[model samples]
Target: MYEAVFHVRGEGPYERATAESTTRIDLWCNDHCDLLSIVGDGEELVLDRIREAVGVSQRLGDGDDRLIVTSACLKQHAEGYVEQYLAAHDCLTLPPLRYENGAKVVRVLALDAANLTAFYRDVASDYAVTVESKRELPTPSVDAPLLSPDALLPALSPRQREVYRTAHEQGYFELPRETTTAEIAATVGIERRTAEHHLRRAEKKLADALVDAL
Candidate 1:
């Protein structure tokens, strides 16, 4: 497997809203919805426009900072947009992984270099596209773990991830229990009950995804 990262200055409601609004929007993909989480004081205004985004067919908002956008017919959009171009080429857009001043930063994964080259050629005319990095993904050998950390880690949400990482770092899972749930909570700056709840939920999700996927 091979992967390359690209920064594309796309033209669309989503990109324009991001550029105009003061808030920062980070997006992630899920089974039922594409989640976009906005931060900073201008979140509400930015999200209002996202709800009315051009390609968005249906949307659900958390009323605070997160919006679940559903774009069912992205494949039908004109090829000038980066997301539509990627959809047409059957390429993967892996981001909310990086950020930049005026471009959409995404990592693209392809089975080989030729596919990536074709994707670049097709998309170059539409947007200001630049390749930030390129690298090969190692083929797993017999002794390698069934899943990579990157694949498994997304099972945990951002907040839950902080708790989980703090727990591990403080030896919460050790035989003698070097850290208490309270300490884990303190480390992540959440309430003790909240921390425990998130920790257990995150662990269960990780187990379900990594173990079952294996």
Candidate 2:
């Protein structure tokens, strides 16, 4: 998967208070292309609404006094119209955008059911944006080891180890005991029945060890 973030700032005739709203507008535009899709001879009214919500003031001084606006856009077709709009508005200017400065990053990843290359290509064609960086990750590893103190006492299996730990940690045998098998099972992501079985086995092993010691 791949992701990119944009950091944007605005100044000039534009009101700075709505910088966040303006960023959201851009994000909304990217997510819903219908807001910017050409329908006639002019831009959509949605853009006007976005500008109003973001507090874009009227162009002042032949738009010479620029509003320093910077924000990042993530998509394959990342450039194009937003850049054009910034240039056209004269009230808005975007400097270099980055992920660290609160730019929204979008991630593109490969799924088991879909061809990644085609999906990425389609997204790239649609967004035409570049990723700042990329990295490959290894598959996760799994390990299961016995973790019960009762196992150290003898005649105990790995399963009993876990059960012993839970019973002690959960105070299963204490007066006004805290925690139940169902709760312990939920915590360990095991079935309640299995938890009970393990607890019983662990208790029996510990009891036998104690008797032997006596």
Candidate 3:
């Protein structure tokens, strides 16, 4: 199996909403409406903008840290062409679709590499598309660990993951510490304090997961 993460920029309400705020919106389409879990700063402002964009919204729970809501599905709003195209090509896009920055990051799976290529070509024709990451997985063993990264570390937000990854790659955890928080912040385009905050959160989450596993 082949896995590819595609960053797609479009005019969909979710995409537009995330573009205007520093929030991340994860989407799942239902038969009648779309289910969304929104997180990050300025969620209230983003939610209000989304309500204006989609016209109808029903908020679930208090939505202080994580907001769960339902709105009109993209298919009903005539903005589901890319989804339809992916379906036609037999590419499965794993949900919830992640909307960050100005694009929707779609994690797709295809049995054949050619199918992935064709799907990317078709979608890129209508919207801006970029492949953020692609990798071929080895077949899982029967004795493989039950806790995958996705299953074990759901608490780390997108920003936390990015900051942690940046720090790791730059050897911030090395014996001599090759990189500083300021350098990581500059690379990630976030304020140093903000980067440090995310890194600390990520490290704590990772530590907790590891200790629990042990």
lDDT tens per residue, model 2, 97-175: 2121123223332222133334434444544444543333234346743222322454333344566687778887789
Order the candidate numbers by lDDT, best to worst.
Answer: 3, 1, 2
The segments of candidate 3 whose C-alpha lies over 4 angstroms from its true place after superposition are 55-64, 137-152, 155-158, 169-193, 208-211
Error of 3 at 105 (Å): 1.2
Which candidate order results from sorting by TM-score in descending order?
3, 1, 2
For model 3, the local distance difference test gives: 0.76
Off by over 4 Å in 2: 1-152
Q: Write the per-residue lDDT of candidate 3 for residues 71-161, one digit (tens) a residue.
A: 6665676577667878888988777778888798888888898889999999999889999888886665789732234545554556777
Candidate whose TM-score is highest: 3
lDDT of each: 0.63, 0.38, 0.76
* TM-score comparison, 1 vs 3, better candidate: 3
Q: Give the TM-score of candidate 3.
A: 0.74
Clash count, one per candidate: 0, 16, 0
Model 1: per-residue lDDT, tens digit, 103-198? 666778777777888888887886688888787888757898434345445434445667888999999889999999998888788799988877
Candidate 2 Cα lDDT to native: 0.38
